[model samples]
Target: MYSMRMFLLFCVLCLMSSTGYSQLPGPPGPKGDPVNDGQHGAAGQLGPAGSPGRPRIPGLSGPAGPPGSAIFCGRGVSGQELETLKNSLAKLELVVNYDFVRRVGQKYFVSYKKRESFSRAVEFCSQRGLELALPQNEEENNILSQFFGDVYKTAWINVNTNKAEGNFEADMKNRPLTFTKWGEGQPDKSIQYTGCTMLSENAFWRVTQECFLNAYIICQM
Candidate 1:
């Protein structure tokens, strides 16, 4: 019985030793379930400002190339269309402040209500591709007079008599005033330095020294 008891004790001791040594942690148990996310880190300090970039260089233009294709140069509107426009001046837009334009024969007359000096009137008309109105015949002069006789008593005409005392000339064509429609007592030499002519209320041509006179101007082309 003594020997059997000793053998049983020895077996128990061996079993306990083997279990302790074999445990070891078992490869960490497959990494738990993954921890919660961590907070974000602070931003780093900004770097120093950089130097300005170099300016862009404009490239030199290349040599002139061959001549381009030829293009037709002619009037944009047809004769019929031009006639329609002339007859219907109120429909066409000649310029600002000119609501209606008059068409006599082949000429176009655009009247301006704003007053300006005769020289200024010429300049204004020239800038708009026109010149001061020059009535070619008695009929034209009478028509113009009738149109503005009541509205404006006197307006600047394209005639200038600076060359000679009684020798009047149309500044437009630089031709002598063949058909003179002088008022009852017109062409007085009182004021001949202004170099401008006026169409009196009676449609008569008169010489005035008031070139700086601000009167309505009629431009024609």
Candidate 2:
């Protein structure tokens, strides 16, 4: 029993000497570099992942995206747009005092006033230094036709048969002093001695009123 006890004690002492007493000298501190400080280190650890390597932030955000491209629309006009443009010209008046006005397509439409003999109409136009009646184009004739239609009459075309008895001639030549905006089917020779003229919408011209009737007329510049 005493020998056994002695052997156990010896074994314990050896184990203590091997483990507890032996101090491993820190790895030969690299020549001039220290171990504890990260100089040559194994002792200075990788420091707990260092807050995930500061999250590798991208350097400076790329330049701003290019400006958004513009879009394309259309060109043609229709409906109200068309009507609006047409009305703009039709209703336009360079001089507000002028009453007879309308749109003869591209041109401004107008006519003479009412209650004037053919001769008086011409004289009035001339005194104002204007042609008694001037039709700019076929469109103007048609537009004036519309006005006569509203009144149901034929119109004088500033022309007449007031020459050499039953003859027709020019205003300066055998032409009358004034004229009418005569519509279609006008001045029927049915009146025998009446060889006169007037205006109407539904061909009002044939009604043969006295020549001295006062009326308006278009002044030509």
Candidate 3:
């Protein structure tokens, strides 16, 4: 019986050696070096854009400036006042130009003492703001004739045949004479009487070819 038991025991021991048996765990082995830190990751892509901001409000305007000056903004003058001003100016002008040395009925005359040619006398009167004397009628003629009788023996009258040889015309009025006192057989049409007319001391009107003859000047206004 003892021998049989030994064989069985031997057989069990062999089985346990061939197949691993459960056992108490041993102390943990030394820890391995901690795993190296992982490599840093690549940068992330940019995020989507954000919405736009609100619009800004404008500032208020400043206060208005002061009123303009009166000289620039005053009312215009009335038409009646303007007309009165114009009339006053006209009267003032007439007064300024009323420088006559002699006067006849509704006529004003200025006699120059010096003698000059007919054209010169016209020019002289024109420079003085007057016209060469043009006796319109017998009354005017007689007045001039008497004046000449007292001073000069002869004077240039503003009558000429410049347009036509025998047709006389008043220089300023530009028409045929309304009155005449020609000497006997005057305006002879001869070369000597073809130039200009003159009033003699006797008040007789005579023509002479010598238009350049120096005679007294009488201007009228």
Q: Best TM-score goes to which candidate?
A: 1
lDDT of 1 by residue, 52-128 (tens): 99999999999999965433255466667766666556434564458446777877777756679888888888887
The lDDT values for all models are 0.72, 0.52, 0.72
lDDT of 2 at 41: 39
Model 1 residue 217 CA deviation (Å) reads 0.8
Q: Is candidate 1 or candidate 3 better by TM-score?
A: 1
Residue lDDT tens for model 2, 108-140: 545544546667767766774345554545555
RMSD of 2: 17.6
Error of 2 at 64 (Å): 67
TM-score of 2: 0.38
List ranges where model 1 is wrong by over 4 Å: 1-97, 149-151, 190-194
Q: Write the per-residue lDDT of candidate 3 for residues 94-157, one digit (tens) a residue.
A: 4355433556666666674668988898889788666788777777777777665454588888
Could you tell me the lDDT of residue 68 within candidate 1? 53
